[model samples]
Target: MATVTRTTRADAPERSRTEHTGGGLRGAVAAEWGKLWTTRTPYVCMAVGVGLTAVFAFYYGSIARINDEPVQAVGKAPIASVILLQFIVVVLAMTTVTSEYATGSIRTSLQWVPVRHRVQLAKAAVTGAVSFVGGVLLGVLGMAVAWVPFRGHASFETGEAVVQLLSIGTYLALVAVLSVGVAFVCRSAVGALASLFFLLAGLPFVLLGPGSEVLRKINDALPQSAGDHFMTGDGDPYPSLVGLLIVLSWAVAAHLIGLAVLRRRDA
Candidate 1:
């Protein structure tokens, strides 16, 4: 008879545990980065965003030129593009989380990582970094495209343009983080998108439309308004620093809530 050997059940769990801990946070992040690029969603989102920005920039530039707007700042030329790009960024970030849930691949992800918080952190890091870079590039591209129609109508200040580009990057990174957190909480793309839409656009409009001082004050404190003030370097109701803090606070709050939910919920 041939000799036979059987592995004990205990050995199986030990091997699994070792495999689970081997990857850790670094591995999780690498995996997330891979997932982000391997899919078509990121590419689609980026292409659509770039196309929309170019179109909007040209339109805005033409309008400014036609109106003979007096030397509008180049930094402000991309404002319209930024508004539309926010939705694109949010969709991209949310998909990172929601897509996995939609396809039931989140279970496999959890199995590989085995640490929920690490998974969340990895997703946040990847999305935030990608959004920041995209935002900066889009800002520069928007300005360049708009300048075609705004050759004589726009004023360019290197310092101001740099500040605006950096601000756009910072704002989009935070917005990406906020969208990721919301995705984890909702676990459905439509649900998360609706919630973010209200927070980023609809609520601001409703509050501002009322034309009440209290409502206006509340709107100013929202993430969208705060981001606007920070990016534009506005100092009307509050300083830029305060505006940044407000946006940061919203991002942090959403992340914490999502983390808590991830810990308690089933994958």
Candidate 2:
């Protein structure tokens, strides 16, 4: 006389590790970190960071010793080397998203964590945090090499040097986070990098055309050209803090755009 309906397993939702945020994201972050460290690209980027710092520092400091231009030692040589290495780090950061597409793991990632923004935020947080640590290490190691060649703090004024070191780390962190945001927007490494090259390399030239002193003067207020402030201790031509704020604004704008795209587009 009793008519009971049977619940079919096929219609059931997939069971996740948690109903929602409840410690799942933390576990995901931990797992993501393991993936990051075990991968070759990240460790290679770390090595490049350390190697660039040491090799370029020694080269620049040696040049300084020969030319007796100790002040320009790290500025001229080490900054270029650091920039090159940081660019590679940025590429690696971009791959955080692209790699999932390449391996077809993104579907599973999305399924496991249906809330899309949370996934992107977690990935960005992990990459940015690790990149910042790497940048800090690179700054310290480069300073060490420069100091060693200078006969143990010979040319490095202690207080000023610490300021430069912090600035170096902060710049690298911003670059890395920006790359992560770009990658999320583009969803392709090559596309994201092409866009970045335009922003960092092209924008400055376009802003400061030849024989346009007035335009160049105001445009120089932008972030890319003003990036040199960290390496230059003299009275910077542009406002250093303003440049930083501009960079932050760019990051925020780019991130919001990417978030909107992620919301509208299919994963």
| Structure candidate 1, residue pairs in collision | none
After superposing candidate 1 on the true structure, give the runs of residues whose Cα lies further than 4 Å from its correct spot: 1-22
Q: Global CA lDDT of candidate 2, please?
A: 0.68
List, residue by residue over 64-149, the lDDT tens digit for candidate 2: 67666534434334455555666766776778877876787777877766777777776767887887677667766776677656
Q: Could you report the Cα RMSD, in angstroms, for every candidate shown?
A: 4.5, 5.5
Judged by lDDT, which candidate is best? 1
Residue-wise lDDT of candidate 1 within 180-225, one digit each (tens)?
9999999999999999999999999999996999999999999999
Pick out the ten consecutive residues of candidate 2 with the lowest summed lDDT. Answer: 14-23
Superposition TM-score, candidate 1 onto the true structure? 0.90
Residue 29, model 1: Cα distance from true site in angstroms: 1.0
**Cα lDDT of all candidates, in order?**
0.91, 0.68
